[model samples]
Target: MSSPTSSRAVPPSSPPSTQAQPAGLWPGLGLSAVAALIALGINHAVPTASALLVAIVMGVILTNVRPLPASTAPGLAVAGKRLLRIGIVLLGLQLSLGDILGLGWGMIGVVIAVVVGGLLVTEFVGRLLGVRPAQRSLIGAGFSICGAAAVAGVEGVIEDKHEEDVVTALALVVLFGTLMIPLVPLASTALGMDPRDSGLWAGLSIHEVAQVVAAAGIIGPSALKVGVIVKLARVLMLAPVMVWFGLQLRRRGGQVEGKRPPLVPLFVAGFLAAALLRTTGWLPASVLDPIKMLQTFLLAAAMFALGTGVTASRLKNVGGRPVVLAAVTTLAVAGIAWSGVMFIG
Candidate 1:
């Protein structure tokens, strides 16, 4: 969590009141918006495809095929981090405490177990396989919670010095999440699972909300409804999990006080507030509908920004360790979630 020191020297006579220039945000935001539009078009053309997935794919292709300008780095960083947090905040509007509790204690317990156990198992497997600790933790969190967003949340706290880890974890999330879209429905049907159970399984185990929705949607509307609620229940665990990681990082020392993510991030608090607002019936249907639309667009943009940070070179340099870790973690989560669903039934 250390703040990066600037190599540039300031003159002793320079005014203390002077501030550094702010990074530009337009380039990144513009690209992200373009990606989102492309994703939207893809989603429209192929109903089963997820906009978020398309956005990320477009980002990766653009970044690798034609490198972005150096000037766009600052804005892309903003799009990746700031926009991501905002999207996560907006994600809260989709959930309510009542909706979660209505799933009953059994389903709630399953979610808790999957999140907690998946995180621990993934981290352990990553470490055992010799992946870097920070990267391992990011992978674990990504699988256990909300995919790239969860990994970004953990990185904000631990402030991993390497950007490669973030990209690697996100790449894996996109890959496995995409794969789950078809596999979950096929497996659920073969197993003769009730649509509700299939939906819950998809929601609890899939890496991203969009992926969860895609998987559940193929199962049916009932499964889609069940999936979203269960997914949000897992999302609710993010704040506490992040706080725990932050505290652990601080205890390890070398953490800069102001640079570290807060124990309860403002965005997480905002998410809770949004959920409460939904529960209160104060937000009219007119307002709620637009906000939901905004949430998808924002997340799609953030995901595109995240994808732009990745490169084929970086992935090659890391070798196959990350892929192996991703595979292990994916299996672990899927197994745990499937077992939980059957046990609950």
Candidate 2:
């Protein structure tokens, strides 16, 4: 004979305690950490292979080969979200305003144009091919900005993004960016371009920072310096672009679960603050070096977490449209960048 209100009330013991949350996260986090360490080892052995790429690929392979335990979910979520955001913030430390501004106004304009133009062209082509809006946006962001990192950043803002879209976008970044590593240097030699021009082209057109570095390294030290700086300039655009995405989602009345995304996500703000800190020359190389290593490991771990979501079955359903879109955008950006290089000269 309990009262109606008392009968309806749930017992306190039924709800999981907040204290248990940290313990629950450890299993998955440990798995991701192990995978990231393995990826680092592989990258150390093969200097040409990117640790992020290696980590993601390993995650994909491991998950597809056999499903992960349910216990890993919480940790994986933290890796994908929190670790990824922190890594992105640390990424800003690598960029210096002085180095980018040194490229001159014309080069700066080219960098902006490439990011904007590439995004537009990718969206147009994606629409023509009947690609889904979310997937297309992800692909466009990845190619136009900084590859997989851009893709991950955009995914955080978009309320309706699927894990499949992220996996597809990342795969495209790896496939097309890798192809450009050798092709760009060979093309530079064939065109008889100087190191500076070649570096500009690589920095502007290549999808990933690592790929640009590899390409520029093939040309010479001067090219490597210019290429890295130009690539960082593109990385700087991630903040504004992510903000734009969040605003667009707001306009559409999109919310994740019941919560609307912020106009500027906390992580994006952190990224900007880190960049300004780097620009101030407050941090010495000794401090920056360890931060860089930590950033890389965090990013690699997050990529591995994201990669676990990719399965062969899901990828098969993605079709060939995205592939065509990637190829078209790759050429489009490369052509636009080359034209800018010639004009600036």
Most accurate candidate by lDDT? 2
TM-score of each: 0.89, 0.92
The lDDT per prediction is: 0.78, 0.85
lDDT of 2 at 183: 99
| Candidate 1 backbone collisions, by pair | none
* Residue range with the least summed lDDT across 10 consecutive positions in model 1: 9-18
Give the poorly placed runs of model 1, Cα more than 4 Å off.
Answer: 1-23, 254-260
| Candidate 2 CA-lDDT value | 0.85
**Which pairs of residues have clashing backbones in candidate 2?**
none
Across residues 71-139, which tens digit of lDDT does each residue of candidate 2 receive? 666677778777888999999999899898999999999999999999899889999999888898899
Tens digit of lDDT per residue, candidate 1, span 183-297? Answer: 9999999999999999999998899888898899999999999898999999888877887887787777636324655566678778778888888888888998888778778
Where in model 2 is the C-alpha error above 4 Å?
1-20
Error of 2 at 329 (Å): 1.2
